[model samples]
Target: MTLYGFRIPKFAALFFWIVVWEIVGQFELMLLFPPFTEVLAAMTDVVTTPSFVEAARITAYCYLVGLSLAVVAGIGLGLLMGLVPAADKLLNMWVNIFLSAPLSALVPVIMILFGMGEPTVIVTVFMFAVWIIALDTRAGVQHVSPSLKEMAFSFGASRVQRLKIVLLSALPEILAGIRLGVIRGVKGVVIGQLLVSIIGVGALFSLYSQNFLMGHFWALILILFAFALSLAELIGRLEQKVEYYAGARG
Candidate 1:
């Protein structure tokens, strides 16, 4: 049969371990790890709390602002750079420096500049991600079919109209870059908050670890993982919608 008699996912492995955990827990092999049942019960409580909602709202706001600005500025600057050889040459060195640097190391410096709060976290996310998104957008523009641009020009399209019609059509690729930027920026938010935030999920994670609440701690990790997966799915759907619209137009 096919690999254990069906199309089984690797995640099925977690179910196996969870069953083993419940058995070991019943036998008192360990308590702090908690049984799968216990952790699931704790998850329902933790995920529903008002405090968790507030923390989620704060994180979402920070992520959106950071991601939105990165998209606008990244695409704008990238287009300009791709269009200008002299500009790329002049800024290439600095761009490479920031891109290569390990942004986690810059959190403290960001904190120094903006203090230990939302501003620091926002700046941290922006610094780590904007360049990569910009680089991708630039590449997308460069690789756009030259024929599409020439058609617009031959049809007497103005510069503004050409950008709006022709260049804008390439947005699905630019959006692909933005999707990556937001994901990368989210990681920065988690790290920045963990390092300096006083009242967010990071604070809760630190508090739980200190109190040795392993089950609850694992619950929080699961929540974050689920949140990230949900976001990626949402972006993937948006990409598909764009493709559908493009096809309909043709």
Candidate 2:
């Protein structure tokens, strides 16, 4: 319905920032911060490079698979905890311990246990993400309206039917936890790559940094920032869409 109001502001902001960057480069503000043009050129060059493509593939692979596993496992564990009080109490302390502990610190142990490989990286991401999701899922299941379950049961719903009809009905809240887990998982997996990757973006970053290619270094970061932002927007929109459709049922 409205188009003219949006593009102008975004274009204006882009130009303003580009002008500021060029001016900062010209003045040599501090002995650091490469020219924006250099960074942009580096970004273009990176996209064309074979190594960059490989690194991108590896990173995306680890993040997507690990995050998926985390979400599925988290939902199952959360539902079990929600339905069983004794299981919840027993798992609570262990969950809290892992949730509070520094996943980054475990990198060394993981490397020792699994050696340097993709599995280790994915596991690191899983470690950083899964507990928070599981905890949130458990809370979501517990908070599901009891009346809904009663209504389902009154219809002679079998145990499986009750779960399918009433328990899994709180998908919105559960998915919220999953979204949070995925965001954290992706970041953790990338960071884990930095710690032990031999052929991912993290490795490329290390290579450029050591060679003093500050332009390329920042260029990689810009790529990652763009990727992260785009993925976040995509998932947020999907979640909203699902919530809207599910709300109609309610």
Candidate 3:
């Protein structure tokens, strides 16, 4: 970032906000926001607790399992839609609808079908993540050069070979979609847990909120934010690495 003709580090904005938060917290400007330092201190305590360890394990399990399912289903659906115009015509409208819908409202339906358990949370994450990934993948596959497919065909490449070529050609957009899906999946997991209110981090959030443990609450939030940002950054790096594929396609 630049300010007054001087370059500023990207984190400078974060630091400034942290300072503001601390000041407001110190002055008791908001009842919901406790001191930042207290929250940091509470973080260590929170992480060390056995309950937190168990909750973390459950949350991680649900997140990973759900996201894995999303990746597989989304990519497959995207490939199908991209390759088959009939599939695209049949499913594109619903995909777009779900992508734009307030997915939280659907969680109760998932809970009813899957039961009020980890399965529900997993499905929630999958639901939140899958559509965008499929859409992006479809876009990437559709944008693959016709000449590339023609060359593959002329070379006697099998159907699977052609599909592989399309996947590689669309790698950049696929990665981009996955990155976005990951972020949404995090939100899904959190929201799912919160709505469920009996499992994972959501349970802990309920515990903290009911008992007025704001410090611990905020600490957990910070942890979630950090995890989401870290994963996004990692995927973004991977996206950059494959950008040449997009250029090649172009």
Q: What overall lDDT goes with each candidate model? A: 0.75, 0.79, 0.95
Model 2 vs. true fold: TM: 0.84
Estimate, for each residue in 151-207, the C-alpha lDDT of model 2 and write its tens digit. 888888899987775445666667677767867886787778988656588899888
Clashes of each: 0, 0, 0
Per-residue lDDT for 1-250 in model 3, tens only? Answer: 7889999999898999999999999999898999899999999999999999999999999999999999999999999999999999999999999999999999888988999899999999999999999999999999999988999999999999988899999999999999999999999999999986479999999999999999999999999999998999999999998898886577
- Reference-based TM-score, model 3: 0.98
Q: What TM-score fits each model?
A: 0.82, 0.84, 0.98
For residue 197, model 1's alpha carbon misses the true position, in angstroms, by 2.9
- Report each candidate's C-alpha RMSD, comma-separated, in the order given: 3.6, 3.8, 0.9
User: Candidate 2: what lDDT?
Assistant: 0.79
Quote the lDDT for 227 in model 2: 80
After superposing candidate 2, which stretches have Cα over 4 Å from the reference? Answer: 1-26, 30-32, 244-250
